[model samples]
Target: MIAALYWSMNIPGQVAMREGLEAQVKIINEQAQQTNARGIKLIPRIAGDGAEGIEKQIQQMYEMVALRPDAIVIQPTDNAALAKPLRAANRAKIPVIAYDQYIDDGELAAYISSDNFQAGVMGGEYVAAHFDNQKPIRLILVEYPHVSSTVERVNGFLDALSGNQQKYQILKTYEAVEPISGQRAGERILADFPQKDSVDVVFTVNDGGGLNVVEALAKAGRNEIFVATIDGDPKSVENIRKNRLTRIDSAQFCGPLGAEAIKAAYNVLRDQPTPRYALIPTFPITRETLSLYPGWAGPIPQDFKKPWSSLEPMWRGQSRVVIP
Candidate 1:
């Protein structure tokens, strides 16, 4: 069997996930060779950056469909933009597995990603714990509105904070999909707010932006604001350990996500039933728990338990909506 693994950008997180996928593919191939069974041929490609990158990803999807790979695993650059090509792959009878980002409209064999909503909830809970309901919190939110995962994270965070709505007020929201965009947005926020007293907390959807926000705060000599975010990048973890501006990070099990994506694609190719959606769980890593964190490129702490782990048996036979 053949598979095409399409990645969005060459960011740190994506790179780590790709490494995990590659490792799993190697193991699978080795086992197949030893057993004299068919092995999956994996073709990997990465998009450029920004708008141009998204276009390239769309083009690559169309090309992958033309190649007629047995299956295609994609981490979409833009959630909606790649729908047409994804549907084309479906029409071609090729199973498409979406990783990290969900395709809003498409016939996907499986959609694998971390429980983004829960990740946001973890961040929100961490922030909420820092202040009592009586204390007012001025919050600045930085988010990437393009991807469904980030959207879920934002919604989850807000949902967690809903109980304390009266205690916290969202001052503004900035759109930042990556580090550079995040830096720009952070600089703007700093320029506008200027004073440390203006903002009490900052919540970023991912560390890519969260780190930049911290930098912006530092540049303006305002590190007093507590920051919480998702994606426990190694730097973010270290920052949290050192008592830096970023206080908490909800870490995604990226390695497991990548391996699961490959496994789900293989199952579909083998004519086996695969879950429409498989959500990996995330854990919060704070300064106190920093030593235990396995870092961004993780082996995932064996002792760490996920709420959905016990429900997998039930999920296996659940009915799924097949996109036409």
Candidate 2:
């Protein structure tokens, strides 16, 4: 059997995404070596991200389908763009395992991803804790609209804040999941909110350009603006420890997430039972809880008493969403 692994836009900004893809590829090779049989052969594809990314990703998907690999595992870039080709793959009777994000339309043998929404909620919870709820918070959001995981994380973060009845006004919204845009966003934040306390909080959807934004704030001596971000890049964690503008960061279990996809695909090929969807949990690394987390290459630490995780059943009733 042969399978193709497709990672949507594996670019420099997304450290965890690249790491996850690498981990997935590594697991596949290891499995093949262990069996020493005619095991599944792998082909890897990455959409060179830029203005032409969607087009490139679409073309890559169609090409993968044409190869007629035994199965395909893809991390979808755009929710709706991949539908047609995915349906084509379905018609060709190829099983697909989607990781990180799901397509708007497709039949997948299995889908696995981090509990992105929960990660966002953790960020929101952190913000909620800092404020007394008497005053409105001025929030700056850094986002990436193309990917489902980023969208879900933003939604989850907002939901947690609103659900907690915390008052906040969105001061500005910027788009950056990579360095250039991220750096531009940082410069813009400084320019727009030159006055201290002009921006109370900055919530970055991921660590891609997020660390850059944090650095920009720190360099400009803008320590008053509280920062919260997702993706447990080691740099982000170190910043938190050093008492930078960033107060909290949610870390994705990237390695485990990728490994799960391969494991699911392996099961699908054998005609075994596979869950329709899997939500691997994400860990929030804050100063108070940083010791518990071991970074991305992790034995994702157990929960400590936090506002969100402390609720009955943990992670507010989604605790069962852990690595299988």
Candidate 3:
């Protein structure tokens, strides 16, 4: 058996997560070798950056399908853009698994990803609790609108804040797709609101952008602004521990997510029943609880308490397998 794993981009944090996925694939192959079962070949390709990168991704998918790999797993660069090529794979009778980011419209054997919406909800809940009875929250949201996962996170964050409109006033929104873009966005925000206490809180979809925001604020000596973000990147985790700026980061259990994705692919290839969608868990890590966090590329903290415990029952019901 053979499978092609197509990654959207080769960013630092994503690279760390990809390593975990690759490790699991190796383990699966090793087990097959020992048991004399059919071993799987894992092929990897990374889409570079921006529009050109998306085009490359589409072309790669078309090429992979032509090669007739048994299965293909992809983290699409864009939600809707990759539909055509993915549909082509469907027509080829090749199983396609959507990993990390989802294809908004396509025939997918399985969809594996973190509970991104819940991650944002965790961020929002943390922010609300921090400012429970305090003055109105002057919030600025930095988001990447291109990807479905980030969009869902932003929507979930907004949903959590909807109940307290009076308490949390949305000041503005900026699109920061990556770290450099986020830095530029941060500079713009600082230029617009020159005062030290201009914005009370900032919510960035990912830690890459959030770190840039932190840098921009720190450079301007605006340590007063509170930040909430997703992606428990090592740098972000360190910042959370050292600097008082970052409040909470909803960590995705990427290692478990990758292992589950491979398992789903294996099941699909074997003509076994697999859930259409599998959502890996996410938990919030704060400065106070940093000691318990097991890092972003995670073996989930055994003793750590899940921030979204109430939603666990529903999550367990939806997920095909329970993750530790």
Candidate 4:
């Protein structure tokens, strides 16, 4: 049996990521009942949310190493903290496949994740194009710095904005990735900027808590605020369609990512030459591009020969798989 270690399931994007992993197990279990082929069993472990959760995850990684599973698939919490266990796994000749997040130390058989940085660039491009004439665009960022994925996204967004020469000043930054903290951010934004047009844009790292911020602002009638967020949560995309505060949401191809991780592990076990790293493209859902997006559970839409923007946030007609 192989072991699968997942980060906090409380986050929507992580939940979507896990769906792909679970789907693999479901298919294998069903196939085992009908055929004579031996079934692959997966041992799943979950971490709690918050600071203590980080400790739990680290401890779990150490324990997983001791179990000596054939392979270990994980969405790591703190990259440096988990290195010891990962290195131990390496010594044991146990292959490790990571998704959603990556660890700096230890050898991973494969790493699969969304193009997080590109997703940020997509958000920045939309902001630059949407407010072309709006100079010195006042911005507020909602970010969580603990994870590499979110940090890469913010860096990509800033880089794109800089490339466009769109002059903008960051007004304030807030931290939150779930409901309670997001509500606090929403309330703080209201308090920080009471007047309309005081703030031009807010970019949230994901929809997990980002949605709550939208609701808080919407309820308070803060219609002028344009929000850009990552993660393809159905609610976030719907908000764009309804013309709400959320303007653009760059969504991850979560199901395929999860399935890919399992496939990568399988390939390693079979001694097949597997790519060390892979990234699934993200679909940026704006009001104009919403029609092209299939919900998280649906199939990935075919590439659009003519995309909505010249920047081209997604792969379009190319393979959904990208190695970068």
How would you encode candidate 3's per-residue C-alpha lDDT over 201-280 as one tens digit per residue? 99999876777888888888888999998988777787788875888888777667777777778878877888888787
- Local accuracy of candidate 2 as per-residue lDDT tens digits, 1-324: 445445434333244555655676576777768988345566777765555666777888888788888888877777888899889989998988888889888798888888888889889877887886678899999999888999998998898888777899998899987666788999999999898878999999877779889989899999998899998878888889998988988888876777677778878887777777888788878888776887676666665567443222254224243433
Alpha-carbon lDDT of model 3: 0.77
Task: Select the stronger candidate by lDDT from 1 and 3.
Answer: 1
Candidate 4 has its poorest 10 consecutive residues by lDDT at 315-324
Pick by lDDT: which candidate is best? 4
Give lDDT tens digits, candidate 1, residues 13-57. Answer: 776778777778888889989999788888777776688888989
- How do the residues 73-109 of candidate 4 rate in per-residue lDDT, one tens digit apiece? 9998876777888899999889999988888788988
Q: Please, what is the whole-model Cα lDDT of each candidate in the order they appear?
A: 0.78, 0.78, 0.77, 0.83
Report the Cα lDDT for residue 256, model 4. 79
Q: After superposition, how far is residue 112 of candidate 2 from its true place, in Å?
A: 0.5
Off by over 4 Å in 2: 1-38, 307-324
Prediction 2 TM-score vs. true: 0.90
Q: Cα miss at 78, model 3 (Å)?
A: 0.6
Q: Predicted candidate 3: what Cα RMSD to the true structure?
A: 3.2
